[model samples]
Target: MGLKSVLSKVFAARVNRELNYLRKNAIALQQKTFTDLVDAAKDTAFGKAHNFAQINNYQDFKANVPVHDYEDLRPYIDRVVKGEENVLWPGKPKYLAKTSGTTSGVKYIPISKESMPQHIKAARNALLSYIHETGNADFVDGKMIFLQGSPVLAEKNGVSTGRLSGIVAHHVPAYLQKNRLPSYATNCIEDWEQKVDAIVEETHNQDMRLISGIPPWCQMYFDRLSAKAGGKKIKDIFPNFKLYVHGGVNYEPYRTRMEDSIGFGIDSIETYPASEGFIAFQDSQKEKGLLLLVDSGIFYEFIPSEEYFNEKPTRINLKDVELEKNYALIMNTSAGLWGYSLGDTIKFISKDPYKIVVTGRIKHYISAFGEHVIGEEVEHALMSVAKQEGIDVVEFTVAPQVNPPAGQLPYHEWFVEFGTPPANLQAFAIKVDKALQTKNIYYFDLIEGNILQPLIIQSLQKDAFINYMRSEGKLGGQNKVPRLANDRKIADGLKGYIS
Candidate 1:
């Protein structure tokens, strides 16, 4: 083994020990993080406005501060963007993670100096944990690639600003710089397709062992590689590739096709990260969910997802969460975000060390007819049926078809791009509809009452989703199609590619 690979094993052992301590003292670690965040920000403008000085406990903090979405805290954020110091967090934010907002347009989330290391640490620990568990550090000697947005950042009020991934790209440790793939110049290419082509040209013959990105972009990279190699499997192109690290979306929908593209199943690590904070990561391959990072520089709160929109929803601390129930993830971060709604829902699978699975987005659900179908249910239904029928799904989205054609009942419309088309499309649709009904009772009741018909599958042509995403100028870099929507915006846009 090379010196770096030997050192990686040693580092992995040390990190695993620290992780065990954190897991064993999960509640205590969370309590300390909570207190630390409140105390650190108590002198800031928001702190003064919210009575943070007088807060002594979780209850005190909760009573003093209210949960805030971007708009709710925009006034303070606006000041920070205008170069105001001590407006939100301590003095000045180190960087603002720019993200596209739905209702609010462009959103700038603060990333403080203190909070920055937490992101880097959590990501590093995820890999180290994998190395420790599997005793595989040989990949450390090989090239690694992360498909991401350009690293070139812009100045906003004298603070560096860019997409979270781009901001993170600037922080890759010096030790790994030599092993990282896709030359900086290639990565800086503005267009994602061009970037992928450049990346392929630069790294196809290298000793690639670790590949990381959101699954869709990784799929795109694999497709480009296959085309270049005359349809050869990805395993043939990079025989040493050992791990596939992904986040931002559930991997189940893309799992079958990704494995097929690679010609084998591979180990994957799922992480739960956001502009707000690095929340959790897969610490064990045998575990079912990502281990929540109780020791990270963020304090967590959870509101029962069903009660999220209700007036004054019940918010509870991490220690109060129960298994199997979904909750809207709320956080108080060192970045000066207090009671910030992350807009994502998660369900705890294990409480011993606080492990969770990303369930869906709070806003991304279909309830046009009051059925309230979520991303998890739809993904589960679709993948389950597809598995039983021996089919391969490339990508899919679900939107309510409230207005159907003449003489037809309104129903849920599923836009599915199939890698392997079913021999009987109607039978496949029936199986998926039945599977969905079993997952959600509301949809089942609606179907039985004739309020909604069984879901109709709009089989898409090859690369339909890729084309749609490209047309919308969201081809890559943390972009993903919503699994379920209440309206037909995406459904309408996808009409042209329907087979």
Candidate 2:
């Protein structure tokens, strides 16, 4: 036990108390957040245009302001981007988190001074919660690394702009500065492969204890480290490493392979973070879902995922959310986004203290033949079979194969990269198909009716996904292959890598 670890335990206790209060008063906290957001922005251009001054409650707000995706809100965002003050919020935004989207192309999400602290605090508290629950804080004294985009920023209209991960790198607490790895110069490398190589050189022999990033990038780092150390596992290179904090993608599919790469199991914390806000974090090792952050500077709304594409979807507040139902997430944040559609879908597993699991992306799914399979379902089905058969799946993606050969019926196609090839590939496919059929009834019905064939697995060569992403110029940072796509864009791109 070092001095830092001792002090962290005491600090963790205090933070836990504050989190408990937030959990206990979840609904009240959300209501207060909603009221504060509306009141603070009442005089802004958007507020005035939306009748925010006359709104008294959720219903009034919903009636006055319609849910908006990026395109719908582009006019106000454009004004803000042109350096206009008080266009969306009371003042100019502190930063713009730039991201790429399918329809909108480039998006600049605001990060107001009022909302930025919530992002930092939510991430900090997630670690503190882990320390409070597990009583293992010694890792605080060792080196930490967050495999992310370059911390470099570009300025537009005097506002700093970059990838959300890169923007967050600027706010890391000063106390952890000395313990953080890959020196500032290394992190600034523009290319990801070069960056990882630089990171491996800097941290392979350091006293690393905590690692954070999305799973795929972290896996890439592990592979680089293993090669640098001549096939030594991650645990051997960094014996002190204890916790892995991951977000932006589900960790389940990569868990087995990642653990094997490390040669042992380690604790992990899942988080729900987006450019717009930090919504939740895994609060307990024993719990299944990430605990929702009601006290954060955001108000949440949900619409049943099935109805998301409808002209007028039914929106429900936090208090009305039901368990196990998929809903498209909506947000009204202190950053000045009002009724903004977040594009992600989530399912509540517990309502007493408000815990949710990221289900899938609203736009990422297979519905060509009306099967409508989601990210969560396909992941669960494949991982379930993988676990049972001791298979080491590196990466995978699903797409609807709408037009196959002349005689073959249209079906879902799965492209998978396997570390250890299965003995019987066709038999393995049948098992995965059965597992998916159990998870999605529509797919089963389609198969039974001869409307579609069983999903075909396209075994991919080593680094197939990496090659595909690299070819598309999305090789690193926050870019990830979608788990499911309605079109053949990704499936067609992956054809060259088929084993």
Candidate 3:
């Protein structure tokens, strides 16, 4: 066989080897991973303060570490920012990745020397796994475009700081960097508009065989590229483009738009990496959910979503998890975060290979009128209706219109940005509403009891959500419009927007 064929086979073999090993020892590996993490941070101040030495296994560790959001860990992270060693981990953090969450602004998550590799390895393996599964490794020989935050990292308290993607960009293997598009200078432009313009100009003609980024920003890039190339579909511009690796947001709403941009179907790989750790990734072509990373430097725990808001929720590990139930993801990583609530929810779709689907954020859902609807339901509802009506959703958010002005009743409000609108808009809303009522029993009951009126549908002007995000000063780079809000704060803001 030729050298290219031989190399492709070798890459497949390597990834399959890891996959086989994981399949064989996943349970034991998960158990040992928790042990390793506990041992590593048992002596840190945060660990010592929690009496980590006495923690022997997942149960003890969970009881001792206490599930924490960024706010709960802020004080300890602030100490790490001040040159403190062994505060959470053994040494000072190499950098702090800054993220301004829509609900909570300005969260600084620490990235340690030990935890950085997990991010890099998980991302690398995700691609490798896809390559092996599809038997397509030739794309590695060509250029790839990664729409990441500016590679220009800022400094705070003598520690490097930047977006998580920006930090990962810094660690892209040097060989691969040679083919990555949007040169360093272009990526450094802080203003997203300027950066995107420069990116379109710089590499619209490059031999790009791969593309990776958050869905919305990448969609923006694709649209601009098409516009600049005289209405060329992305596939026409980069004929060799083979893979689209996406993360940082659910890709469902953007799927139709992205496919339309390319003008053809393409394979995609989804990753569940966060600033906290690289959690899970799509490891199979036939599979529907991400395979949980068993050997990554992070250990996993799950709290059932129903009990997540309880005074004391049940947190379980791999051995005890069940299928088809939504659970809040809790993680402990070698990176010094012990029992941190990553704020995301997931549902296991498989047990043999240990795969999961991201359900949504712990705090991101709508239950405004006693109709508890989670992210998974909303996404499924949108995707179902969009597919049935042959439309493409750009972005959307749901909020309940509570407190009726007079004789009217409270109902759910849907603000949808559609790329393709059905001719009958009334039927479109009816289909979407019926889909939600089917998925969520609570919502169905409200409708049945006459406690809630029919859902209202408002067509969002194109880029309405984008404009709202831009107004928030968070136009791109991992920033997303929250899929569901508890209150009308975001809904009202979007109403006042140009959309």
Candidate 4:
């Protein structure tokens, strides 16, 4: 083998060895907590995992730890908010990560001292892997710009409490942190509107080499920057930018638009970050999927997607999990989320259990009119139609609206917002219908002489939907227009423009 191949093999072997050692250690360390909880639940007979009383072995553990959603943890969260110890873990949490969902309002998620290391470790490993994969460790000889939240701590009752991103930024390595870039603390901390101009001004002549954040916000920043620079590209603003890192949701929809807005083909990496913890990250290659930080401060359980919707869900241990299978993630973290379900679905793409791809959100499924449609199916259908019709969508959300008709099944009404609208809207819609029908037989059956009709396209004015979201007090942050809604509530909310 050549020297490069041999070196690659050596590095892979080291990573594998470290992963194995960590996994083995974690099993023993984590079991202490798991066993104690199992005993306590058995004793209480009313706790969440009380059903696991019958479990004598790992099989019992799998069967008994009932699958739970965020709603199920409301009481625990309340306790945490009230400063209760051991709500999910053993001590007072260091901070609370703020997150929200379609059903849940702003959630204050607890993060313990132990879990902080895991988050940091996962982020570091991902960065190192990226460096190794791209052989670009030296690319950031210049300042690294983190397009993140502000470092200004929120004041409550005259005391300083910080946002999650602020706290994380405070801990970033001093050497790696940008000295020239705008302070997220001063510039991007307040209302997004106030932050946008500062972001534009700060980045105008900076030597930013790395940019990281959610895609939509990054897009907005670049758009504003381009406009301020008299239509100059992102490369013109920061001529040395070498890498872009983004997470929270899929970046596929905004990838092309972002590239165009930036006017350069920089390396891109995606991360799977959550309020609970930094779970996984795309390695350097960006093609091998994300590596799960198994040794980091979290213990993971995988529930097969097939069994996800079942009333009683079964969880598989990481030691025995397989690749290419859809699994609902269960996390037991130092942050105190034992057997807690994060409501995300992922599939392993590599033999290493760490390498995974986030498929979709578990609650983001639609079954209106008895035709069950999932995120993967919808994304696939959209991509297929885009390829067939030569349309490029900047972003889109699908909601199943019921149109009940006499002697007919209910059909889906798609609300699509495209960057490149097709010349023949009807043809594009028909192509989408065909794509869905081909992928899902149920969709085909629903369409054949039934109530379901062709997919409808509503080409929105550029930034129209974004403006709407901003008006709703939901823009400029982690919030993106949700992809799929089970019912017509969100869809109806977006009416008037649906043509």
Candidate 5:
């Protein structure tokens, strides 16, 4: 066998064995993970304050450590930034991943030496697992272009900090460094537009095989490459391209445009990596769920999405989860974050190896009319409507029209940027409205009671979301517009640029 074929088989065999072990010993693995985390942090300031040494099981851990979001952990994080050792974890963190939410404000999250390897390993394994399952290793023989954020890092209080993608980019295996696209100088350009132009000039003729990026940015890269090649499809330029690994946003809405850009359907792998930790990734091509990393140095807890906003919420671990329940995920990481809210909601699709799909963000939902619509429901409604109407959704978002122009019942306002407009515009709106009514009972009742009017469909200018994000200084790299908002924030903002 050729070297590529031989290495592919070896990796496939090793990943299969690892997957089997995780599946077989899931419970034991999870319990041991909890035990190890508690043991390691028992004497740190956070652990000591919470009496971590006395914690012996999931019950004890939950009872002592309260669930927290970034704001909740700010005090400890502030201390960590001030060069405090053993503030949250056992020692000082070497790096911090800076992130911001839709509402605005920066969150500096610790990346301890203990936790860095977990992120790296999860990313590497995500690609390897895909290769193992699909027997597609020839792609690795060529270059894989990771459209990453800048690799240049900044420091604060003797600790380095930058975008998670940037930090991860710097640590890519030296062997792949020879084949990874976007020169280090291009990655350091700092301006998104300038970088894209530089990237286009640099990669137009390279023999690329795999592409990884968040969908919108990937869409932008593909568009630039195609434009430079004079309307040629990405496949025409790089025939060897095979895999498209993406995350940071739902890939469904962007699928059609992406396929059109590449001129073909390429295999894709999804992951759920956050600043807190590398969470999960698509593991089986036969299955639809992402395999949760059981022993990946992070302990997990789940709060039912319905009860998460309630006064008293039920917290469960690996041993107590059920399939098909909406959950707000919480993590106690290899870093010293105890019960930190990742802000994302997810649903379990499989349990043997603990597989899940990200449902939405805890705050990224619309219940404006008591409809309690979640991100998963919005995605399903849009996809269903688009499929039936035979149109392609480029991007979309919704907000409650709490106050309309009078004589009209308040309802949802949907801003859609379509790749291909439907022949009958009313049919598109009807389908979108009808699909939501079927999925959400409160929405159905509001429509039936005539308390809410038919949903408004406002066509958005092509690149509206990209422009809006650019205005907010979040044009590229891990930024996304919330598909559903509880109020007029996202909707009003987009209305300013409607087509």
Candidate 6:
């Protein structure tokens, strides 16, 4: 290995060692003073001008400071955009991570310099955890491919205006950096069309080992790669690939399709990445749930999902959190967000303090048809059916659609793609329908003709859904197919291939 590789290995080793030390001493670390956390947060842009006095102190801060949704912080975000340093924390934010809000349109989330360490540490811990679980740290020594957004810094009026990814790319260790294939292979730097072309070209003949990114985009890239390789399997192209790191959205639907397209059984490592912060990561084994990076320059809170939706929403601190209960995740990050609800739901899988599973998005549910189907429930039902009926469903999307006749009640339509045809496709569909009915009571009622028709299964052609996403200009980067659609609009839009 070269000097850079040697240095990176050393750095990675040190980071791994530190993470193990922290994990071994997690209980003691959890006892860290809230005052110190608040003080550190104050030093960043988020806490600078905010009245810590209003909340009194750390104890009162926890008691009185209500959990805030993106809407509640809109004014603060606006203030930051207007050059108000106090609202965003103190120093000028380096960049704004542009993200889509559920009700709100586009949001530009501020990221500070101090928050960079947290992101890096959390990501590193995730990597180390994956290594510990899978015994595959050796892959890190090889060239890893990050299927991410463009690293090209944008230029407005001839000056460099970089996004967060571009800024972070510069800080990646030179050894790891060298191993990275040219940006053209994975980055959407130029216009969308041009970026796709670049990605196709750059990934042409690389010995990529570890692939990481959103599922939809990664799948699309593989589709293109598969086409270019003239129907050759993914193993034929990237023979060195060992793992697939995915985050940004749920991976259940795309998991089967990915393995089918890639022609291998590489492990899938899920991540809990948000514009606000890199919150958690899947251990390498891909069996245990994600591990939260608690001490990574952020203070966390968990409001019970019911309380979050109640008339008088109540919040809970880390100390009050219980295992296996669903909660709306909130965080006070080094990035300056205070009591910010991430708009995601998670359930503790283990009491080691940080092991949890991303259950679902708070707003991503299908209650329109009275099914009360959330992402996790749907994923579980789908996985169960797939296992019982022996179907290898790669990717899927479920939406409530008005089918058969206009006045008829809506039904859940599932678009699925399989790797190998099950012995009984009809029986598989029946099992899935039954699974949905049993697991989700609302779905059961709907199937009983109280609200809707039985679930309809659509088996898509190989790589068909991926092409559809690419055609919509949402192929790569952070975009992924929505698992559950509550309205008929998105459902109807996907109607052409109901076979």
TM-score of 5: 0.98
Q: What lDDT does the true structure give each of the candidates?
A: 0.92, 0.93, 0.85, 0.69, 0.86, 0.69
Q: Which ten residues in a row have the lowest lDDT in candidate 2?
A: 256-265
Candidate 1: which pairs clash?
none
Looking at model 5, the pairs that clash are: none
TM-score of 4: 0.86
Tens digit of lDDT per residue, candidate 3, span 1-499?
3354457568777877988798678899999998888888888999899988898867687677788887788899889877788999898888898887655678888988888988898887888787677778777788888888877788887889998888988898876777788898888888888888898898887888889999999999998999999999999999988789998788888888899899887899999888888888898888799988899888888899989989999989888999999999988888788778888999999888888999898788888776779988988988898898798788889888897679999988888888877787788888888999999999999999999987887888888887888888878777788888788888898886434
For model 1, the stretches where C-alpha displacement exceeds 4 angstroms are none
lDDT tens readout by residue for model 6, 194-292: 565576687778778888777777776787788888998888898878888888777776677788888977777788777688877775473578767
Query: Per-residue lDDT tens digits of candidate 5, residues 24-113?
Result: 888898889999999999999999999998998777887899998888888999999888899899878979998885543888989988
Error of 2 at 89 (Å): 0.9
Global local distance difference test of model 2: 0.93
How many collisions per candidate? 0, 0, 0, 4, 0, 9
Q: List runs of model 3 lying over 4 Å from the truth.
A: 1-8, 497-499
Local distance difference test, candidate 4 = 0.69
**What's each prediction's TM-score?**
0.99, 0.99, 0.97, 0.86, 0.98, 0.86
**Per-residue lDDT of candidate 2, residues 1-499 (tens digit):** 8888999999999999999999899999999999999999999999999999999999999999999999999999999988998988999999999999988999999999999999999999999999999999989999999888888999989899998988989999999899898799999998988999999999999999999998999999999999999999999999999999999999999998899898898999998989999999999998899999998889999999999999998899999999999999999998899999999999999987899999999999999998889999999999999889988899999998888899999988999999997889889999999999999999999999999999899999999999999999899899999998998899899999999
Model 5, runs deviating above 4 Å: 1-5
RMSD of each: 0.9, 0.8, 1.7, 4.9, 1.3, 3.6
Minimum summed lDDT over a 10-residue window in model 1 is located at 34-43
lDDT of 3: 0.85
Instruction: Report how far residue 282 has shifted in candidate 3, in Å.
Output: 0.7
Over 4 Å off, model 2:
none
Q: Among all windows of ten consecutive residues in candidate 5, which has the lowest summed lDDT? A: 1-10
Looking at candidate 1, what is the lDDT of residue 387? 94
CA shift at 133, candidate 4, in angstroms?
1.9
